[model samples]
Target: MSRYVALGSSMAAGPGIRPSAPGAPFGSGRSARNYAHLVAERLNLDLVDVTFSGATTAHVLHERQRSARPQIEALDGSEELVTITIGGNDVGYVPLLMAASLPAIARRLLAGRVRELFDRAARERALDDVADALRGVGTAVRGRAPQARVVFVDYLTLLPAEGAPAAPLSVEHADLGRFVCARLEDVTAAAAQATGCELVRAGHASRGHDGWSADPWAVAAGLPLPWRPAPFHPNAAGMRAVADLILEQVGKN
Candidate 1:
C-alpha cells in the first residue's frame, strides 16, 4: 500500500464525530470516519493522520499541538500522497461563526466587539498570515516528499448564500460571515496555485449544501449532541462528500 499523510485542523479532523480514530490522542478529536480515514480505506493506503482540532498552520508546520509532533514532521520522502485542509483558524472563521450563533441579546451586547474583530483591515491582515503559512507548508512538504501528490482541499461552505434566511444570525452578522468564508476560500485557492499542488474545490462543491441547506453537509451552530459533530464543523455526510471528491482526482491518476 502507498503511504498517505493527512494534515490540518478540526475541519479536517471531524471533531465529535462518532468512534474516535484508533490510537489518536483525546485532544486530537480525530474521527475514525473523517475524510482521511475514509479515503485510506477506499484506496488501501497506509495512513498517518496528524489532524487535530483548532490547528493553525503554525501547528502543522512547526508548533507541537497537544504534545504531538508538528503535523508536517509526520512526513518522509517515501509517502505518495498528502492532503491539507487548514487556515480557517488563522483568520478566526469558526470563532466568528460561533459569535453569530449567540442568542439575540448576547449577540447585541457583543456586536460592537465582534464587528471590530471582523473589520476588513484586520481580516485582510490575518489572511496575509494564512497565505504565507500555506506557502511555507507547500514548500516544506515538497522538500520532505518530492514524489507525493499534494492536494489542498479548502473548507466547506458554512453559511447560506447571500439573502438566504440564516437563523441564529441577524442579517448583518450573516453577511459578515459569508464575506469571511469567501475570502478564506480565495486565499486557499491562490496558495494551491502558487504551490503547484492539486486543488480540491470542496468549498465550491458544497455551495448549496451549507449548514442552512435542507441537506446540510456542515453542522449548523446549535446545542451539541452526543457523538455528533461540533457546531460550525463538518458532519459525517460532509466527510463522505469530501472523501469522494478526493477520490475523483486521486483515482484518475
Candidate 2:
C-alpha cells in the first residue's frame, strides 16, 4: 500500500546528481538523490523510478526507446502516489532555446541579426501536439492507477528575473527563453485541468533562484552536476524543493 511510482524526463530523473542507476532502454538518468527518491525516503514508500534523460510523453504512453517499457505500466492500481515532469523534450525545449540564443550571445559585440533557429509556426504546432499527448497521459495514468494520487509536476525556472548570466546571453536571448518556458508552464496547466490531475506548479514555486542566482535551485545550460556530467537540469537544491513541495501536498511534513 506504500508504492510510489515516479516517471518523466531528465529533470524528474535528476540527470546530474549521482549515484545514477542503470536501466535497459536508457542506461543512466535516474539519480539516487532525485526528488522521487527523496520523497520516497521521507514518506517511507517503495519507490519505482523509471525516469529517463530524453523521455517524451510518447515514452510514458508507449516506450519511445528500445528496451524501455511504457512508463505507465509500472502502476497496477496498487500505488499510493505518482509524480511526473514531462513534455519539455517533446518540443526540444532546452536545446531549441539554447540554439536560438547562443549565437546571439557569442557574437553580441557585432550587432548581427540574431537568427531565429526555431520556426514559429512549427513550434506552435508542436506545442499543440504536446497538449494532446498530455491529455492522453493523464487519462492513462488515472485508468491504470485508480487509487493513486497523481501529481503533474512542472519544471523549475531556468532563468532569473534578469535572465541567466552564465550563458552571458543577451538580455533579449534570456528574456525569450524565459517567455517560452512560461508558456510551456501554461500549457501544462491547461493539460492538468483537462485531465483532473493535481498540478504541482514547481515553476511558480521556483522563482528568482534560477540558474543565474547565487542560491539557484536549477542549473544553467552547461553547469555540471557535482561529480557528474549533467546539465540544464535541476540541481540538488531544486530536487529537494520538489520533494518538499510534493510532501506538502500529501499532507506530510
- The residue-level lDDT of candidate 2 at 233 comes to 77
Please report, as a residue range, the 10-residue window in candidate 2 with the lowest summed lDDT. Answer: 109-118
Per residue, candidate 1 scores C-alpha lDDT tens digits across 19-137 of: 89999886788999999999999999999999999999999888987779899999988989999999999988888878778886876888887786657678778888888888888
The Cα local distance difference test for each model comes to 0.89, 0.78
Model 2 per-residue lDDT tens digits across residues 33-128:
999999999999999998888889999988755567888888888989988789988876776655644555454643332233355555566778
> What is the TM-score of candidate 2?
0.87
TM-score of each: 0.95, 0.87
For this target, which candidate reaches the highest TM-score against the unseen true structure? 1
lDDT of 2: 0.78
Instruction: For model 1, give the 10-residue run with minimal summed lDDT.
Output: 112-121
